[model samples]
Target: MDTASGLTYAVLGTGALGGYYGACLQKAGLEVHYLLRSDFDLVQRQGLVIESPDGDFALPQVNAYRRSPDMPRCDVVIVALKTTQNHLLPDLLPPVVKDDGVVLVLQNGLGVEAEAAAIAGPERVLGGLCFLCSNKVGPGRIRHLDYKKISMGEYSAAGEAVGITDRMRRIAADFERADIPIELAEDLVLARWKKLMWNIPFNGLSVVLNATTQDMMANPDARSLAEALMEEVMKGAAAQGRAIAPEFVQTMLDHTAKMKPYRTSMKIDYDEKRPLEVEAMYGNPLRAAQAVGARLPQIQTLYQQLRFLDAQNRGL
Candidate 1:
């Protein structure tokens, strides 16, 4: 479909990431439907309240639904659910997405786009790597701490480069209209691996060591360990034909250093006793590396630790 004419969006997961972005789009005068779980009634009754560094805003009225089948079939579906809950997508996607609509996964970790592709079809799937620091503080309320940009690209079944297409450009336009910066990536796989350079270190260490971003960056030993994990992620990427630059490691370190003292999503999940996305964030990447004869011992150790922690926390 020609989204330039005006695209309607369905936000499948209305939490920190999804709620913030969907509210932004709706506030910008675009049609957006949000699918909520526990807070569906609260959002529908009170609407969404966003507290951001940019500014504070509230949507007095929102298009909120408790289920996908209740929402109108939309031109674009944004999947912002944590990978731990992605099993719901197979049943949640088809009902609310138009026949020709696309699914844009605003998620972290590796192989997520492929999972979405399996549900929505390869050509209809797009990957978006979000660099947002936001949290759902309460029902229908989000606190946006810092950084809101997305790198997006079309998905390829072969994991090859798919340059920017009109579909991507059209989607970028809508996000840009809502004041979100969008970088068009030529290779989705490379972009995902690049994201892991930061996610692998900070997200994993945050849970295992019970530290925040500032805590890890402040201590010399923790900082060194984080960098080593990043190097392993770089190696994993290279093994998969995505050669990340050596300097990119330092770039991620610098970025995290300047970021606010915040707990990563995985750490927050662990703290809340919610299921951590151990498999998606760590397991899949490790397996991908091992498949290509690349050994990431440090990352493997971290992955195992996280798995243990997740099982113990959730009582599995």
Candidate 2:
């Protein structure tokens, strides 16, 4: 059932991003259904708790469910699943999203929206690049760290020609009304690549060296490696016919230097005995670069290291 606000929202993965965004919408008076896994029972009873530097709040009652099929068809389906859990979407998305529903992918890595487009059709898919640092510290608890802005773009199967369709405007309106800061992107491919400028360096390096973003930036060698990785990402993006500004590399570096000392999501996953998203975060970008006749040696070495590391201490 739609609220007076007129959009029924469904959250596919009720982790940090999903829980935080879904709660934002719900608190703003929109109807949002959260499909939970490990925290299903606790959330169904105690609801969600959000810890943000801006302010903290608790939602004591949420439309929480454990099964996807039990969710109502939604106007907007925000997918916050880690690229690691994307395998479940084939069974989950079709029933939860309405015919004209838009599926927003809030994930890390490149070429991820393609998976959603393949399932929901290209026109129905949208890419959302999240620039927030939040973590599900425990069942029903999410801690929001540094930034919280999302850059959104319409998805195309061919990954060509970006524009702002009426749907994009409406979705942007929906997000804005919920007090979530958003940016509209004319080129989805470029936005994805720009986001990669940060992910490639920090996410993998933090895991491989067992360091935080600040640690990498503070160390001379690690800082140099991060800059080199960012350069390769720009080259790979250009190879794909999408050019991200070179200045973005420095921009990301400066921003991360000022942010709080925090562990990346991939590092957390590795530390928690869960699967690291090597393929989605590192593997996909590597293949994309290779497909475009671009070679990223630094990224390739990082990928191999992550693959081996994932194979080794994953049980911890």
Candidate number with greatest TM-score: 1
Model 1: per-residue Cα lDDT over 114-204, one tens digit each: 7789988999999999999899999999999988999999899988998989999988999988989999999999999999998899899
Error of 1 at 256 (Å): 2.0
The parts of candidate 1 lying over 4 Å away from their true place are: 1-5
Worst 10 residues of 2 by lDDT: 1-10
lDDT for 195 in candidate 2 is 83
Q: Which stretches of model 2 miss by more than 4 angstroms?
A: 1-5
lDDT of all predictions: 0.92, 0.88
Q: Which pairs of residues have clashing backbones in candidate 1?
A: none
Query: How close is every model to the real structure, measured as TM-score?
Result: 0.97, 0.95
lDDT by residue (1-316, candidate 2, tens digit) is 3334577899999998999999888887888999999899999999999999878999999999899999999999999998888999999899899998889999888888877888999889999999888888899899988778999998888888678888888777777787788999999888888888888889899999999988888999999999999999999899999877778888989988998887888898889868888887789888988987999999999999998988887643
Q: Return the TM-score for candidate 2, rounded to 2 decimals.
A: 0.95
